[model samples]
Target: MITDDKDFEAKSIIARMQRIDKWPLPPSFLAIIALGYFFTFYDVTDIGFAMPSIAPQFHLTGSESLFLALSIGLIGYVIGSFIIGYLADRYGRYPMLILTMILMALGSFGDAASVNLDMLIVFRFITGLGLGADLNLIPAYIGEFAPAEKRGHLAQITFFLGILGQAVTPFVALAIVPPFYYGWRVLFLIGGLIAVIAVVLRAELPRSPRWLIGHDQIKKADDVVSKFENYLKSNGETLPELKTDDINKINVQTETTRLSFLYLWQKPYRLRMLVFGLWWGLWYIGNYAFLGDAATILSDSGISLASSILFLAIGAIGYPIGAISSWAISDKFERKYIIFVGSILWLIGMLIFGSKANSIALIVGSFIASYSLAFLIGIAYMYTSESYPTRARTSGFAMGDGLGHIGGAIGALFLPLWVAEIGFFGGFAFIGITTLIAGIILVVGGSIATRQQLETISA
Candidate 1:
C-alpha cells in the first residue's frame, strides 16, 4: 500500500538508526550508568541490614518506630520522583542525574553521622529523594539511547548490576555489623564514597540524543548522532549516507507537541499510565513487604539472627540469576507476558515460603520470590519508560514509580504488624494474594512491547 518514496524513506531511516546501534559506545555508556545505580541499591538495602543494630542504639523497640524509620524514605522517594521526573523532562537528563548523585553522596554521609533517630530518618529521607530520582531517570536515559533491538537487554544489564549491589549487602552486613556492631555507620560512609566516585565518572558521559531531538535541539542531536557515525567509520563499518528526510521526520514528530502531566491522563496514554501504575504498585507492595523484611521475618520464626542473615544472603543470589534470565529473554518475548509469568511465580514462591517458616522453606521460597521479583523489575523499567514518547518518558516513569512507592511504604509499615498479629504464613499469604491479583490485572490489560521502537509504541 505504500508509495515507492515512502518505502524508501522508511528503509533509509531504519538503516541510519541501525548504524547508530552498531556503534561501539554502548557498553561503556551502560557501565557508567550502571555504576551510579549500583550505589543507589547499596544505600537502600544497607538500611535493612543496619536496622537490627540500629534498633537497640536508638531504642526503636516499638513497631511504630521501626515503621517510621523504614517508610519515611519512601515518602521522600515519592516526592522526589514526581518532582525530578518533571525537571528531567523540562531541563535535561544528564544535569538532573548529576544533581541526584551529589544529593545521594551528601545524604549518605549525613545518615552515617546521625546522632539521633530523628536525624537518621531525615537523612534517610534525603537519600531516598536522590534514589527515587535516579530510579526514574536512569532507565529513561538508557531507553532513549539504546537501539530498539538491544534496548531491553541493555536496560536489564544495568538493573542486573544494581541488583548485584543489593545481593552483596547481606554479606557486607555479616562481615561488618556483628564484629564492629557500630559498623552500620561505616556502611553508609562507604555508600557515600562510592556515590561521589560515580558522579565523577558519569560526568564524562554525553546527553541523550533522543532527548535532544525531542526538545527541538536538532543541531545538538545531529552532532551527537554524527559523532556515533564517525566512530563507526573509524572502526571500519560501512554506513549509508545520512538521510535528511529521515532526520526531518523525527524532528517533525517530536517537535510539535509539548508534554505535560495532564497529557498522561488523555487518550492512549491514560490507559498505558493506568496499567503501568497498577503493575508497579502491586509488585512493590508484595516484593518489598517480603524481601525488605526477610531477615526480621526469619528471626521472628525462631531462626537466629546470624542464621537468618546467612539464609538471606543465599536467597539474594537469585537477584542476579533472575536478571540474567530477563536479559536473555527480554527482546524475545512480550514484556507484558514476561511480567505476568513473573507475578505467578512470585505468588507460588510466597505460598511455598509462607506455608512453612522453617529454614529450608525460607531459603528456597526466598530464592524463588527474589528471582521472580527481579524478572519483573528488569522488564518493568523498560516497559514503563518505553510506553510513553520521549517528551514525557521521564515524567511518565516517575509518576508510575513514585505512586508505586506508596505501596512499598505501606507494605513496609504494615508487614511487621501483619507478622506480629498473625504469623509468617499469614504475612506471605497476604503478599501472595496481592501478587496473584497483579498477575490477573496484567493478563487482562497489559500491552505487548517487544523489540518495538519507542516512538512507534508511543504513537
Candidate 2:
C-alpha cells in the first residue's frame, strides 16, 4: 500500500507530474487508466445482451422483468456509490478501488451460483454495489492523476470502455449465453475473470500523490512520487524534483474533514449538485429506459431479434466514438454546451423515432438517438468529474449517478407499461419530451463548478 508521508519541497501537482517522467506511449497514463476501466465496464454492460433471453426465463413482465435486472442492481449501486465514494476520500482512492473490484468479482461469482429470481436479484445487487463504487471512484482517480491538458482525454476512457463493453455484449452472448444450462452464469464469471486480471495489472499503479499530500501524508506522497519517477526512468525518462511552490498548491488549506454525503447539498455546491444529478437522471430516462425496453419495443413493431440486436449494437458503437471525440474536446468547451447538444440530438432523434416506429426510417432514427445518447453520457461523465473539488468529486458523481440510476429505475417501471398501454411510439414520445425538458434546464443555467476551473482561472 502506498503511504502518505515523505520529505520534499511542496509544489503544484501538475508541475510535479510533468517533471517526474514521461512514458514512451502517447499519454501512457491513459493506457493504464483505460485498461483498469475496461474490466470495470465489461461487468456493467455484459448483461444487456442477456436481457432479452433472461427476461423470458425468469418469467418477467416487460417492465417488471427488466426492472428486476436493472433497477435492483442500480438501487444497490446508488447505495454503494454513496458509501464507497465517501470512503475513497477517507481511505485513499487506490485502496478503495481494489476493494471495490474484489466485491464486484465476488458478486459476479455469487450471481453465477444463484438458483432463483430472489437469489439472482440479491447477487445482482451485490454486483451493482461494487460497480457503483467503480463508477464513482475511477473517474475521480483518473482526473486527479492526469495533467490538465489530457484530463478529458483520460477521463473519457471510462465512458469509452462502458460502450465497448456494450458493443461486445452480442458476441459474448452468442458465444456464452445459453444452449448450455449455465449460460447466464457464464456472464458473471467472465466479469470476475476480467476484474482479477485488472487487479494484477494495477499492482504497479500508485495512489494519487496529490490526494496523499492533501491529507497531510507528505512522506507517503513523496514515496509515491519517487516510485513514479523511478518507473519513468525505467521507461527512459528523467526525474524532476517537486518544487515548494507547487507543493503549497497541492496542499491548499481546507477545514472540511469527513467528506459527508451532506456536503453535496451545501451552498454553491448545491446548485452544481442539482445540475449534475438531474441531468444524469434525465439522460438515462432517454437512454437506458429506451434501450432496456428496446427489444420489446421492436418486437411489438414486428421487427426480428436479429435486426433488433444489430441496430442496437450499431447504436452502441456510436458511444465510444463520440466519447473519444468529446474527451478530446471537453477542455475546450463549457461542460453545459456539450450536454446541451447531446440532449438536443436525443430529443430530435427520439421524436423522429417515435413518430415513425413502423417505418425503416424509425430504425435509422433510433440508431441516431442511440448515438447521441452515448455522446451525452460521455459528456455527462466529464462534466460530473469536473463538477466537484477533488476532495468531493467521487461523492458528487455518486449522488449524481445515483440520480441517473433512479431514472433508469423509473424507465424500468414505466417504459414497458407505456408501451403496453399507448404503444411503443407513444412511450418513446413521452420520454423524448421529458429528456428535452432536462436539456432545457441545463441550457438555462448549468455551468462548470469544479475546482479544476478555479485552478485554471487562478493560473
Candidate 3:
C-alpha cells in the first residue's frame, strides 16, 4: 500500500511537469529573450554594412583581406559553440545565457572602439563567441518551454524576430554611414547598448523546468511547474486531473542519466545528426556568400554604393515576409519537406541573381534568395531544437550549427576569390549548385518532425 502511494505521488509530479504545455505563452519571457536575439542579429549583420567604410580606413583593398576580416569572427563561433554548449548542458541554461549576453555587450563595445583592423578582428571574434552561444542556447530554451502543438510556431517566431534585427541593419547603416564615414562605430555601440538592456530584461525570467528534471533537481522542477500552473490559473484556465496509474507509470520510467556526446552518436541519433550537420553547413555557405558581401557584390556589378544599400534595404523586406510564411506553415507541414522546398527555392533565386547583371534581376533575385534562406532557417530551428533530448539538446544544436559556421567561414573566404576569378555569374552558380546538393541530401536522409513532443520525437 505504501509503495503504491509513493508511486502515485511521483507520477502526479511528473504529470504536472508535462502539463506545462497547457499554460499561456509567457510574453515576458519571450520578449526578453527576443531582445537578446535582436542584438545578436544587429551586431552580426551590421558588419557587412560597415565593411565598405572600414576597408578604406584600414587600407584593405584586396578581396582576400576583406574576406579574412569578415570571417575571423566565425573562428570564435566554433570555439564558443562547442565549449559553451557543453557547459550549458553541464551547468544550467539561465547562467550561461546571462554570461553570453554580457560577453556580447563587451565585445560590441570593443569593436566600436577599435582603432585598426587587427583590433577590430579581435573584437569581432569575441562578439562571435556570444552570437554562437545565443544560436545554440536560445532555441533550446524556447523548445523546452513551448508546448508540442505550438513549438514550431514559437521557435520560428523568435527566429524571425531576430531576422528583423538583420533587416533593420541596412537602413541603420544607410542613415549613419554615408554622411559620416565613421558612423559604423556608432552602430556597434548601439548594438552593445541593446545587449546590456537584454541582460536586464532576461534577469527576470525563470530557468527551464525540463532542464531541472533532466538534472535530477526534482524539487526545483516541481516548483517551476507549480509556478507555470499558477500562471495559467491566473489566466482563468482549469487544470485536468491526472490518473494515479498514469502517474505511477511515469515514475517507474523516470531516471536521470548523464547524456554525453557519445550518446548522441549512438543508434537513432547519429543519422539525425548527420542530416542536421549537412543541412546547416550547406545552407550557411550560400547564405553568408550572398549577404556577407551584398554591398560589395552590387558595387562590383556596376551599381553605386548608395544604390546598393537601397537595394539591400528593399531586399531586406524578404526577411520578415519569409519569417511570416514559415510561421504560418511550420505546424501545417512536415519540417523536412519545408526545408527541401526552401532549399530548392534558394537555389533558383541564386541562379537568377547570377544569370545577369541587370539591376532588375539583381534586386528581384536577391529578394527571392534572401526570403528563401530565412524561411529555411525558421523551419531548421524548429526541427533542430526538437530533435534531441533535453539533457543534450544544446550540445547537439551547437555542434551542428558550428559545422554550419565552418562552412560560412569558408564561403566568406573563397566566394570573393571565385568572384574575382570567374565573375558574379560563376560565384552565384557555385552557391546554387552547392545548395541543390544539400537539398537532395536532406530529402534522402532527414526525418519528419511535426506536431510532436520533443521527448517523443527524440525517442
Q: Which ten residues in a row have the lowest lDDT in candidate 1?
A: 248-257
**Measured by TM-score, how close is model 3 to the native structure?**
0.93
lDDT of 1 at 294: 65
lDDT (tens digit, per residue) of candidate 1 on 291-337: 56767767766777778788777887888898899889998988888
**lDDT agreement with native, every candidate:** 0.79, 0.67, 0.79
Pairing residues by index, what is the TM-score of model 2?
0.85
- The segments of candidate 2 whose C-alpha lies over 4 angstroms from its true place after superposition are 1-15, 18-29, 174-182, 229-251, 355-363, 449-459
- Measured by TM-score, the strongest candidate is 3
RMSD of each: 3.7, 4.0, 2.7
Lowest lDDT sum, 10 consecutive residues, model 2, at: 1-10
Model 1 stretches with alpha carbons more than 4 Å out: 1-15, 23-26, 241-259
lDDT of 2 by residue, 177-274 (tens): 64555676787788788777666665656787667765666667667766766666777776656666665554342216585467667866788778
lDDT of predicted model 1: 0.79
Off by over 4 Å in 3: 1-14, 20-25, 244-259
